[model samples]
Target chain A: MIQMNPSMRAAGWLLTFAVVVAGAVPWFLWGSSQLIGGLPLWLWWHIGWMIVATAIFAAFTRHGWDRYLGGIDA
Target chain B: MPNPALLSGGLSTAATSVELLVVVGYLLVALLVGLVAYRLTGTDAEDYYLASRSIGTLVLLFTTFATLLSAFTFFAGPNLAYRQGPEWILVMGTMDGILFAILWYLIGYKQWLIGQQHGYVTLPEMLGDRFGSTRLRGLVAGVSLFWLFPYVMLQQMGAGEALVGLTDGAVPYWGGAALITVFMILYVGLAGMRGVAWTDTIQGLFMLGVIWIAVAWVLSAVGGPAVAAAGLDANNPTFLALGSSFYTPQYIISTAVVIAFGVTMFPQINQRFFVAESAAVLKRSFALWPVLVLLLFVPAFLLGTWAAGLGISVPEGANVLPVLLGEYTPGWFAALVIAGAMAAMMSSSDSMLLSGSSYFTRDLYRPFVEPAVTADREGWLARGGVVAFATGTFLTSLTRPGTLIQVGSTAFGGFAQLTLPVMVALYWPNTTRRGMLAGIGGSQLLYLSHVFVPTVPVDIGGTTISLFARTYGGWDVALAGMALGAALTIGVSWVTTAGVDEAAERFAVGAD
Candidate 1:
């Protein structure tokens, strides 16, 4: 069962905000490092994350997700 | 202005006019095919949108390959290889091929399975059904709005570029763009996907033949692939490195995403699956598309490599093929190239127009205009959207630089993000609906920010010279968005929603 109760719904905005902050801090620090020199950190981060991302997507698509979303009895 | 003619190794307006006549002749033939295809395509909306799905493996093979090849293979592919060296060719034709192969393996069966169950016509429909969210369908259509404009712009660019080359000064920017826009609008809107697939067969054949002739001529004029390879090796010796090709790793990985993620998920392909009369037709057709892809590229490689061996200067991007055609071949041959190029542009344009309009009409107007709309009205809406979309793209491109690749990459990057959730949702039993929503929402946020911001490329092959990107977060918002969203969708999805709803019956039976 999904754990998202009303409390979790309240937490949604916090997660979204955290996402923005997570991306922004490094970005602000890197501040156009991408423009002048290229965002080495960001690029490497993406490269590393791409692998993770792809694996997650692969798993999500290839493995059955219906059990989680639709529940067992159905 | 009179269409210029080619004189000696260059285009002369008078000679160009002669070539124009040949092009017009080809256009006449295409018009006949379009009109006839329209009549034969039948009255049902499915027939209009997906070619009655009765198309066999042969038609499916040619149609899919032709759709993939587009004007790019004929124009941009050669030129890209010319500038970047053989490395570029291998990266796109081979590397991209590898990505497509992933599609054959991952998403193909799921597509056929879904088509059988739901009579689905597009991605938005499928997503909407799975999620029980017409709002989701609207969301998808909205996302598509961001994605398709750039694609249409690229198709318009191809048309203008081809006309400029074939007509010399006579077919100026506005005129050429207008002509392609009018023709594509007429064919795509009137006949729908039915016209597109049938015409695609012809376009595919014409371009294939032209590439062969052009490559053969160029090779004989120079030597062969070995000689050509040696010449390029001497110039850009590393042109053979799969890793370092001028084409980007982004393209390869992205293509893999496309191959894996998109093979079954694209709206038109979704529609095509339903149109097939039997599941067997789907399997055979799926197997056949790749072979067509392989056959189309051989001559293109030959043309690029041969041109290099002779020390012929390849034009910057699209101009590479035209410049070579004008230089190495004679007048009649030059005219044939014009016709072939038209096929390339038309095939690409028609398909893009259909896909974009489908999103607008089926996904957007229907939901908003009349929530309880019927199938007949949906067809009309699709046609109307086609007119609006075509006119908008034609008009915008006339005012812009008309670079197909730029528009294409932006669209590819944008739409490609959709691949993440859709692909994952298909097979993952544990994936929550919230996860799909999260992945889509999260990725779009990142993708648009990166694309609009246009930060530095994490330059794939070598160091890219990005003025602002040097230290910025190399703006692959699209790529990262897809990745990040994938993670969040999976992670958050599992943690968030309490559990499965009764709505998930279809996905459970034979999800990817």
Candidate 2:
């Protein structure tokens, strides 16, 4: 079992929620059939969002992971 | 340049033979890897089951990647994209990619921590130990096995479909399904987790390489992505846009949520949470998971969507990947890609059978049938369980109950039903055994009712609602069950007397 400060945990969850919602659906891009880079704009939104997700996950694992494991900061 | 005869399942004898040979060669390599891993395996249960908890970052990452992306990714993913549109990418690639990574950290990382501390090998064992209840452990194992059986069968179904398509029906569906079943039982029964992981790593890498090559080759052959997109816009304009009859907001949200939670409960994947050698290894794997998902899913699903614009004719209920490859790529290259698809299926099946055997022996058999079982004897029993379980799934697969996507989604829903209870048990100290059992058992029943019973429409405020519908108001029935399960778990815990507070304290953060 491991623990982290309540404030840190809340912030981590908020970040996760934001990322999840960001990629959940491209509501604003719907009905736009414009193509960029040989793919639909909506499709590109998903692709770019996926890259952003990858970056967020990388940052989370690198920085917040120790706090999750109940390290010195905790 | 497209060969209509080949697309219609009429390949020359030489072409069929060459493709069959390539598939056979791939299977042989997997078997040889199994043999080597068997030689390296230690005698004890931990050594056999968890690979002595020493899997490195790449192996752990690929094994998890390969195990999760099965025949579904190779076949059903593209098939859906071909039928519905590229929005399948949002459901599988973008949303699920991110959601699953988050869960891997929240659920998997915590499981790893507790596993290391208590030396727990199975989810049921951990839950049972925490709540001090053997029946709850056995119940969890039963529910897990119930759902896992269909998923294992799904891989066999995929193998059957892939081979039949690649060989143009020169190989019967039964023959292809039977072939993977026999090999899976042999290696998984013999080598355990070490062998499964080793082969999974090979299969994972092979699948990725072959799919990427197929994508690049197909793109060049179709005169590049720009031309393909133009063709799609001219031919199937609906596909290029979103907000279709199927890709509704609720549909995307529910499917992504269901798959994310469901994947964590899969015996094959859940057990991997305990296999990472260190916190660094686990962190590295989860961090890389979404990227790996995008790499495979985008290409696979995009190829399916592209096939529609290429005017590729697909037979009823057939996967579009093999047909697309056969049209653009040469015989040998297409065969190699099909072999890679087989690799995807085999990787998933082997891991499922390996982890399932552990659940059977440790959680179900040891506690109920033989509490004093030796490590060596338990190891033998687990091997036997693998053989028996594989045989059962193979027999059921011969019936060919549903399409790859249908069967796979049903299994995912079943497993998703277990997630809320497991999560509650893991985090909440007040979660009673009764609450856990009610949550798991109640959710499973609700989910099964939706699956088994026919839908009946009832009028509510002039709006007709279909009871027992697989998807009501675009939301999947699995989410409804999960909502109920969550409610039962939390609601029941608050009112019930806590009998396992002492046992549960061990799982509390910072507790000694």
Using lDDT as the measure, the top candidate is 2
Question: For residue B1, what is the lDDT in candidate 1?
Answer: 26
TM-score of each: 0.77, 0.94
Q: How many residue pairs clash in each candidate at the backbone level?
A: 44, 0
DockQ of 2: 0.47
Model 2, position A67, has a per-residue lDDT of 63
Q: What is the DockQ of each candidate?
A: 0.02, 0.47
lDDT score, candidate 2, position B441: 83
**CA lDDT of every candidate:** 0.60, 0.84
Candidate of highest TM-score: 2
Candidate 2, residues A1-74, lDDT tens digits: the string is 36777787769667775755565568888777788878888877777777777777787777667665534544
What's the TM-score of candidate 2 when only chain A is evaluated? 0.66
In angstroms, the error of model 1 at B483 is 1.3
lDDT of 2 by residue, B1-512 (tens): 32434432465687787787787777778888889999999978888889999999999998888898788888988989888889888888644578788788778988888898899988999898888889899999999999999999998888888888887777788878888898788778778788888888888888888889998999998889999998898888889887788888888788888988999999999999999998889888877776788788888999999999889888764578988998999988998888877866886898898889889999999999999999879878888888888889889999989988899999999999998888887878789888887898889999999999999999999999999999977889999899899889888888887773338865755321
